[model samples]
Target: MNSPRLAPPTTWFRMGLHRYLGWEQAVTLAANRLSGFRPVRAVFATASRLGDGIGWYAILLGLAWHDGLVAFQPVGWMLGTALVGLLLYGAIKKLTARPRPCAVCDGIRLSVHPLDKYSFPSGHTLHAVNFSLQLTAYAPELAWLVVPFALLVAASRMVLGLHYLSDVLAGALLGGLLAMLALLAQ
Candidate 1:
């Protein structure tokens, strides 16, 4: 017969997989390299911790406390966005089941111990962007600090090799959208 034989589904899948993984690995390795210096490692590690931990909340709480209960409306807005955004992040992570960059990229910084296994969408960056959005809407003056801090948090995820650029950027965009929705609700 003159008909051509098509490759099996598994073979096609493997080829596609390798192409994406190879690209992801190369990008991850390059970003991980930025963490070679001790100061960068220290900054990124701390940024990751602060991003993922209660540090963000501490800042929110402090702001709310300083401004009184009525001024705490911004905190409510941020928390609501965080809740929705994080839920979306969790769903994407579960569906993708992507591994952390550190797991794929050897010679990683091994900064702070990650709380979860998969790293499709970064919760830290999600929170950072959501909070920053609310801050921008409520307090433009703080946006100068908040915006940079959010960007740093997003970058920290890559520097620590915990996430890819796609993960953080997706988180940031989704987070901003969620915050906007929360604002409408408010």
Candidate 2:
């Protein structure tokens, strides 16, 4: 008997990726539904805005103030890593050209304006996680603050309809990897 024909490798990969994207879009829509509530929307919008870099910058300045000149090393690392992250994420976003959930899905509500046109990996979340990991490593005491802020920033991306779950996950993973590399270099 002849065996059934198998789909090509590229077809199989595309099918899997499409299915994953469908699931991610569903999750993004579900989270975005919560944006209808004014308070919830406000909170996430604020978080998304802060994750734009102001929060991280303030934290860096605080560290410098607290540690004086000693904060130079960690602050330098954070700045460098963040610059790399900015470049990496911008390049990947352009390469992926993934549309924001709000732009693609009918049910997804945009709670905040996106920083860039594409949304493959969340820049807000990338910076949040990067700064949180580096700060917590340098001063464990700041974990209580930075970790929750990072989590908020990540969640806000989806809830605000600026990114899909996959985008946020990719950003977190990339951020974590960058942090690890920075730590190793130190």
Candidate 3:
């Protein structure tokens, strides 16, 4: 009889190895509970609720609907970067049907209202990374704030046990690549 070939380790296993080291429960709890903080909750809530509609509106208003030298130029760049990154993220999500961590893991409880879809690469992390990268490219001085904020967004997904580390890593890479392409195209 031929031996069976084991499947490669899932992205969850590689990125979520920390869970086996005793911090899984603690980190999940922190990620889930931190949302209770008003400011933190507000930030996440706003991002989550806006979806892609806001991005669309910004792009339209800034690029197609506006006509100004100083103001429209920056808006055009910002909207262009955000739109390209978001479109790429959506495409990847559609292509990879990986299940969300919560769907596969019984070890942790997820947020009550978590997104309903695959979790190979987190959309939230991608958005944050892309936005930060674009901002950094435009105004290098804001690196201190943008970098930390991007890190926080990635950490929040991990803490919430909503994504594997690999998901965030892939998302960061995707965002950076898309942002670079967008900038280059401009």
CA lDDT of each prediction against the hidden true structure: 0.81, 0.91, 0.65
Query: What are the RMSD figures for all models against the true structure?
Result: 3.0, 1.2, 6.4
Better of 1 and 2 by lDDT: 2
- Writing each residue's lDDT as its tens digit, candidate 3 over 1-186 gives 999986577966865675653454454555656666667766655544443245324533543444455445555666676667677777787899777666776665564356658777877787777767776776577678667767766776765557766678888898788778767876
lDDT agreement of model 1 with the native: 0.81
Worst 10 residues of 1 by lDDT: 104-113
Residue clash pairs of candidate 2: none
Instruction: Single out the weakest 10-residue window by summed lDDT for candidate 2.
Output: 107-116
Q: Best-fitting candidate, measured by TM-score?
A: 2
Give the per-residue Cα lDDT of candidate 3 at 9. Answer: 79
Q: Which residue pairs in candidate 1 collide?
A: none
Query: Evaluated with lDDT, which candidate comes out highest?
Result: 2
Q: Give the TM-score (vs. native) of candidate 3.
A: 0.63
- The lDDT, on a scale of 0 to 1, for candidate 3 is 0.65
Candidate 3 versus truth, CA RMSD in Å, comes to 6.4
> Which scores better on TM-score, 2 or 3?
2
| Clash count list over all predictions | 0, 0, 0
Please, what are the lDDT tens digits per residue for candidate 1 over residues 1-186?
598999999999999988987887777777778888889888878777778747678878878877888767778778767777778988899999988878876666666678899887888888898888887788787887788888888988887778887788788888878888888888
